[model samples]
Target: MKIATYNVNGVNGRLPVLLRWLAEAQPDVVCLQELKAPDDKFPEQAIREAGYQAIWHGQKSWNGVAILSRIGAIHETMRGLPDDPTDQQSRYIEAAVNGILIAALYLPNGNPKPGPKFDYKLRWFDRLIDHAETLATSGLPAILAGDFNVVPTERDVYKPERWMDDALFAPEARAAYFRLLEQGWTDALRTCHPTETIYTFWDYFRNAYGRNAGLRLDHILLSPALAERLKEAQVDAQVRGWEKTSDHAPVWVRLRN
Candidate 1:
């Protein structure tokens, strides 16, 4: 089965392109981040017409997540990260598709370091770490996939020096990401192509896409059971060049069932 993740940027604006990719890639399960639409605006009929059923957690204009499954599967859309008493972002959703438990996430951007937003980013990562631990103990094959908004290494970005102060490449952000990986989860892209400069997201400004300047912010982290069956992993870079495309492309993995 193939499972993929994409940050469509905005559900309504990118609907056509997303549907095109869904038709072409044909992943059994697709997780999305940054839907940037309200719950009532998710276009459920459009997705269903494209042959996929979806469950989404949405908020207005900022963050949202969804899971699309080809075959009917057990799905759960949780409200917020555990242990956050006041957190109210629609950034996570989990579901069971063909016996695999999966979560789609959109970690906060938290730009302009040394500020409250950056602090929130770290706190959110901490929450994710705690959630990951529980998933680890669940003993079922599970995957955490989405636009993490993080760049784990210099190789994961276009220019190390250029991105130092950016939220995605900050040492603190990278360190937290590493901690998550240490909790027995495998970064599927690196597992399959560790040495390659595999990137899943490119900025829309400064001709970034045309120049091929990008980052591997989108990812699929799998539990041991799922990692053991991992057969292939890749980014569908061509999708970035599609008409009215999102700045981010789809990253996916194929695994033996």
Candidate 2:
């Protein structure tokens, strides 16, 4: 089975690019973030036509997430993180598909730091860390894949010095991410290619992609059971160069049955 994750930026606006990639990649399961559309606005029919059944959590012009599967029925488990009743951002969705427990998330992009947004980002990370601990030890074949909004290490980003003040690169956020990994979840890409400079996102400005300046924000984490089955992990870098494409390119892993 092939599983993938992508931050689409906007589902409807980039539907064409998405469908084309779906056709090309043909992943059995996909986790998408940043729908930037309300639930009613998600292009369900289009995705259905593309041979996928999906469950999505969407918001108006902002954070959203979804899971698409072509292998079997998607048994949706939850729509948002537990323990946050007041929080209403559509950033998470989880489901069981083809014997795998999977989650899709769009972690907050806290910018202009040392403020409410940054604080919220850390708070959210705390919640995710707690919840992920449960999943990590669940003994189920599971995956946590999405745009984490975290530059986990200096190697994960292009210029560590320039992004020091940024929320995504903040020590606290990176620590939280590392803590999550320590819970027995394997970072599939990094595990597969530890020393390689792999990136999943590029800035729209400064000709970032052309200059090979990017960040490995999107990720696919596997539980111990699935980690042992990881056969290949890669980024479809060329997709980012497509016309009107998302800033994030799809990252995927091939798993042995």
Candidate 3:
């Protein structure tokens, strides 16, 4: 089965690009982030017509997440990350599709470091880590796929030194990512292409995509059961060049059924 994750930036604005990609890539399951729409505003009909069933948690003009399944009904397991009752952002969603448990997340961007946003980001990571430990030991085929808003290592960014002070590349954030891996979830793309400087996102400014100046932000992490079945992984980098596309490209993994 092929599963993929994409941060569309705005689902309505980029509906055309998304539909076009769906027709071309045809992943069995897809996790989408940054819907930037209200619950009633989601283009459910259009997505349904594209041969997939979807469950989405949407908020007005910002953070949202969804899961789409082409093969079977997507049994929703959770709508938001646990342990944050005051937190209302629609950032995490989980479901079961085709016998695999999938968690789709849009982690906090935490830009302009040394501030409240950055603190929130770290706190969020801690919450995610706490829950992930449970998932890792659930003994079910599972995958955590989405835009993590993090650069796990020096190789994950185009210029490590230049980004050292940035929230996404901060030592604390990278350490949190390493802690997740310690829970036994394998970084699918990195594990498949260990030494390659693979990237999934590029800034629209400064001709970043053309210059191949990018960051590996989107990820697909596999639990032990699913990791054992991991057959292939890749970033559809060319998708970033599409007209009116999001800064992020699609990242996917294939597992042996």
Cα lDDT tens digits for candidate 1, 128-228: 99999888777889999999999999999998899988999999999999998888899999999979988898888998888889988998999976789
Off by over 4 Å in 1: none
Put down candidate 2 lDDT per residue, 1-257, tens digits, no spaces.
Answer: 99999999899999999999999999999999999999999999999999999999999999999999999999999889998899999998999999999999899998869999998898998999999999988889999999999999999999889999999899998999999999999999999999999999999999999998999999899987678989999999999999999999999999999
Model 3 worst lDDT run, 10 consecutive residues: 159-168
Model 3, runs deviating above 4 Å? none
Clash count for candidate 3 is: 0
CA lDDT scores, all candidates in order: 0.91, 0.94, 0.94
Q: Against the hidden reference, what TM-scores do the models get?
A: 0.98, 0.99, 0.99
Clashing pairs in 3: none
Model with the higher TM-score, candidate 1 or 2: 2
lDDT of 3 by residue, 100-178 (tens): 9999999999988999999999999999999888999999888999999999989999988989889989889999999
